[model samples]
Target: MNMRNLIVFSLLSLFMGLFLVLAFSLAGSGGVPQSMGVNNSFGEIKIKRMVAPDFSLDLYDDREIRLSELRGNVVVLDFWSSWCSPCRKEAAVLAEVYLEYRDKGVVFLGISIWDRDEDALAHIEEFDVQYPSGPDSKGEILVEYGVTGIPEKVFIDQRGNKVRKFTGPSTKDELVAILDDMLGSGY
Candidate 1:
């Protein structure tokens, strides 16, 4: 081949090799492939890029509850342990918000992590939590959600998308504001 043709062929080969490397990297990362059609509901759901891992736990009442089952309503998943002081302080605020918004289709599920069921139940009783509370028994929820501390709150939109996350104690006003926004969206 002439020099010009050789140069052109080399450039084309280089471009093709780069494209294949990028494609392989993307495929190995397990990201949504561009070839596969994107789900339109993902955009409508509001939580982009972050997938909420599903889990099931036993409630204090001995009933099994699955996070995926509450997909039609906004959910607040509070991760707490009875030994956490900040969690103790935040329990009442959570309860208040639950009471105010439960009728409006908002659900709060308190999942205790790294604590005994009896102690968690005692704290719930002490804080007067009327909503369903449960034990994370195997720490699966903590690991799935990447929780490194106690009293982490995750807000899931009506479409089962995780829209927001908060670590530490949340005031009543903050909780109320979030609920207001979620309710305003007609969820």
Candidate 2:
């Protein structure tokens, strides 16, 4: 090959190598696959009463549970992580609400995503959370639930229909109001 052509080929190879390294690093970090389209913002997304997707995951205690099995009770599926500051702030509030309404037939499930299992478990324990929680293995459930960010809460009614979603840190009052609405709807 000519000198100029040789130099261009070498540069192209270097760029390709760099791209591969970056791609693999991202994949290793529990990053969602690009085709999943999970990075889309939820700003305009509104929760509607629709059939909740069936998902089964392993809890931190090593037991497998399915969302479908949690029917007949209001389910609060929270997508959060140890690294998310907002999640740390919201965990206590969620715990308090869970304790208050758990006897009233409410089930809270914390789905930790894109984080180490140990860290997730530690955060749950640190916050004194009394909810069924598990890691979203490979982010598959997060993609399915359209979770674009941390601290997202999806509320499902007694009939297993997704009724509402809160995308950020929510106050206790806000959670109470949401619960009241869901209960009033008689779903």
Candidate 3:
């Protein structure tokens, strides 16, 4: 083979070897443990327990939601966009859960990311989302939360610590269980 062709072939082989090593390591490590595993039909969900970053999000309705101000309340921060189908699919689940826990001191805040204000507002109306939702306009809040994809939800405890992150469209049952656990823990 020519020198150029040989160089390309060697690079491809190196990348393939690295990929296989990562795959094996992840498989052998069993990856992060979760109360529920990934359901292929739905999507991948990752669980994380850590301190949540605080931000003051200005909703489209001229209201501001400060994460630090929400101390002593269980908060669910939903990151979504109008163009994402998974976000649309999880809309009802969020609305239903919001209704069920609204009176129970649980707070739900929707952060519309990577979309126009008009589109985000329209999506909220179309989904009939009653919770306080606003556009991430500049995407500052999105970056602060480390959101890599849409339909990711972060659950924060009452003490303003210990956030549980869900990286995909979560089901009603799963949301309920998490909220129940947070509420019952008296944190």
Candidate 4:
């Protein structure tokens, strides 16, 4: 190869190697994949009961769950990762809420983005999470929902409307209040 051609080839190989390292690093970080287009800005809210985008995902327990199939029931989609500290805190609260309202016609599904299956599984077991959760292997749901960070939550009502959303970790009381209103627990 000519001197100029050799230099270009070497540079190209260096960039490719860097890209692979970054991809693999991110794949292990338990955060959302950067290619999925993050939108972590729920601070400037223009909330509405828009249709919750539908998706089908494979759960760790060998079950396939579909958002559209969950109509007529309240659905709470939690975007989280094992490596995130806040997500670890949220897991306990989520399990508490899930235990309380699961039988009351509410479904809580955890979507693990930018994560490996074993790490996600370890997180679930560590937190004693009783809810169904799994890896979003291709980040399809994250991109669809505009998720930009760990521990983000999207609440869908019985009619499949994306009625509300919460970014960051939420407390048990906060989640309970929302569920109570959605399910009309007292009425």
**Which number leads on lDDT?**
2
TM-score of 2: 0.80
TM-score for each of the candidates: 0.72, 0.80, 0.73, 0.78
Model 1 weakest 10-residue run by lDDT: 36-45
Off by over 4 Å in 4: 1-45, 185-187
**Candidate 3 lowest-lDDT run of ten:** 31-40
Cα-based lDDT at residue 103, candidate 4: 90
**In candidate 4, what are the lDDT values of residues 48-89, reduced to their tens digit?**
768988889899999999999999889999988876767777
lDDT of 3 at 163: 60
Cα shift from native, residue 133, model 4 (Å): 1.0
lDDT of each: 0.78, 0.83, 0.80, 0.82
Clashing pairs in 2: none
Candidate order by TM-score, decreasing, is 2, 4, 3, 1
Error of 4 at 8 (Å): 7.1
lDDT of 3 by residue, 1-187 (tens): 9999999999999999999877765673344212122222444355566678888889888989888998888999998877677788889889999999999989999998766677788889898999998877787887877777777788889878746777778899998888998899944
What's the residue-level lDDT of 65 in candidate 1?
A: 90
lDDT against true structure, model 3: 0.80
Worst 10 residues of 4 by lDDT: 36-45
Clashes of each: 0, 0, 0, 0
| TM-score comparison, 3 vs 4, better candidate | 4
Residue-wise C-alpha lDDT for candidate 2, range 1-187, written one tens digit per residue? 9999999999999999999977986784566332232223433248667999999989998899999999988899989887777778889999999999998878999998877888888998999998989998788888888887777888889999887876778899988988877777755
